[model samples]
Target: MRSFFMPFAIYVLGLAVFAQGTSEFMLSGLVPDVADDLHISIPAAGWLTSAYAVGMVLGAPLVAMLSIRWPRRRALLIFLLTFLLAHVLGAMTSSFEVLLGTRIVAALANAGFLAVGLAAASAMVGSQAKGRATSVLLSGVTLACIAGVPLGAVLSEFWGWRSAFWAVAIVSVPAVIAILCAVPASAVDPNAPTARHELRALRTPRLAVTLLLGALVNGATFCTFTYLAPLVTDVAALSTNWVPVALALFGIGSFVGVTIGGRFADTKPLQLLTIGAIALLGGWLLFALTAANPITALALVFVQGTLSFAVGSTLIAQALYAATDAPTLAGGFATAAFNVGAAVGPVLGGIAIDAGLGYRSPLLVSAALVALALVSYSVARNAAHRSNHSRGRSPESF
Candidate 1:
């Protein structure tokens, strides 16, 4: 086995993957800027976010299952190249429709990139370091919240949303180069045994429940967060400049949440997920009630972002536990489901606002989704315990 500095590999891979992420999420804060520049409605601008996630949902597992036999490094390189080219296309395009179309293309690569990246990152270090490496990769996502998103928003304010795409284009190329240079080539065989094994893993009751929990939890979080900028600026009376800072603060919160949540995920991942969803419900409710005050509203927003994304590493950890026989496929599939949640959040929130439900209604709806997920988890847990008890006894003994 070749020796690799887990931290450096993580930093490089995470940054490369982070560029892909920021390309998707930075659009959330820049919606108004994008709308104004393209002469489109804000609802239309939101499709850019939805389109990217839709691509991820369609791409992640489809690629993962199909490429099961390919070398990991080669697959990643192909994905990264496409991811970079999509941004280049976005930067040069003038039509909002073309931009939206390009975003979906980018997501195809982005989802495959992340699914492969998670597998590669896990292989970087020793066994004990797997959770930490996953956390570090996900931390890239948290970093985008602090550094990438705010910077994108500021650039959009000055140079228009095109500048944001240009920034994404610039960073993506170098990251792609570094990834290609640094990552060692490795393959996971997709022969009948592995295929049959993963198919069996997918059929497991625990794995199904875990993916369900992920969709519900993620849908709950995004249902409010995708519209967070609009809620802060239009409904809460904050200046546009403040959107950057608020986003940065929210990123900081996510940093704390993920670090703390990462540790808990290893020990009792599913239990932690239920707890995280409860926190999400509380955060959304608080946001809905207090969004009228700028300072208080931003505080809740930061807390919401922090708590929700912090739960991510935990959720992935849960999926791995549930599908231990097929970590890569589970990771890819669960993440695609999470991407589906992202697609739903902005589109639903944007529609609610457009329909005159008011900005706060989205947060309220998020609260309800969280509440529903919480109940579902409780029932699942109870049923699991009962099943265990039933299995412990002999059927003929009675």
Candidate 2:
């Protein structure tokens, strides 16, 4: 703990993950290239992204449980190496089958990195610093939306689509080195868990609620954001130039909210969620109304990204409290929810858009989902409060 770089290890891990994320999402813009190269349709090429997310959801908990008994630092190293190798495989492969296989392999490795990295960051810092620590680790994800994916877009624009994979491979090497050097060895739990322990953790009602809530919450947000570029272009009447700025502002908001939200969750989880949930509804309402106004619409979009993303850390904290018996499994499952949303959101949003209801439909749907979540949480919180009162204990006693 005395090591100053110990906490900063979160940042190091963030960069490595940023590279991995770029590798996964960079394919969005490369759909045309993949289609032409593989003699497939643009829609078919989108499967690369779908395959990766599927692998993440499928791989997350399984890898988390298996790797629990291993040292966190060592597990993280192996995960990074596996991620790097997947990029290399993509770089080398010409066959679409090979590419899909490579992506699924990379996704499995990425899941391990995400699950272990967050847990490691938590173990490194004291309870008081959890908010800030989670913020630092989460900043990587924010950057993925801001810098990493955009940078990969640049790579595809200038170089061939395949070359983007090479760039990620090159970038990941230094991140791996940095993580290995910066992350303190003694900062890991020696006794992570066995498969039996992780299974026991998943049975808790509170944990299940939190994880399901995480999935629903994230799906609500991404259902809107996955179509943001199109919204700004078609509705906001802006060129692609401003999309980067919009995403950056949103990422900054999310990054800031993480620190603030983490602190709030630590002291006032229910109150903070209610406030943010209210704001989330307002944010979408503004986006839906002013989506034709570029400046205001961008601001509204940024608001959605910020408040919505910060909800994750709060939910993670709630899940941790629920699964006191098996934090590792809960942590990994929570991460999986984020990936699940990543998969479900875009598909649903696309269908809504295709039905001629237009791009703003996703925003409306998200607002409704958030409203439902708010109501659900209220009931759950009240029940827990009453249960605690009957036992002559505090709701925070867990």
Highest TM-score scorer:
2
TM-score, every prediction: 0.85, 0.92
Error of 1 at 71 (Å): 1.2
Worst 10 residues of 2 by lDDT: 1-10
Worst 10 residues of 1 by lDDT: 389-398
Candidate 2 lDDT, tens digit per residue, 68-152?
A: 8777778888988988888888878778888899999889888888878777777677554454555666667777767777787
RMSD of every prediction = 4.5, 2.6
The segments of candidate 1 whose C-alpha lies over 4 angstroms from its true place after superposition are 1-7, 29-46, 93-101, 125-130, 156-160, 187-197, 233-237, 350-357, 389-398
Score residue 228 of candidate 1 by CA lDDT: 70
> Residue 96, candidate 1: how far off, in angstroms?
5.9
Candidate 1 has an lDDT of: 0.75
Clashes of 2: 0
lDDT of 2 at 158: 84
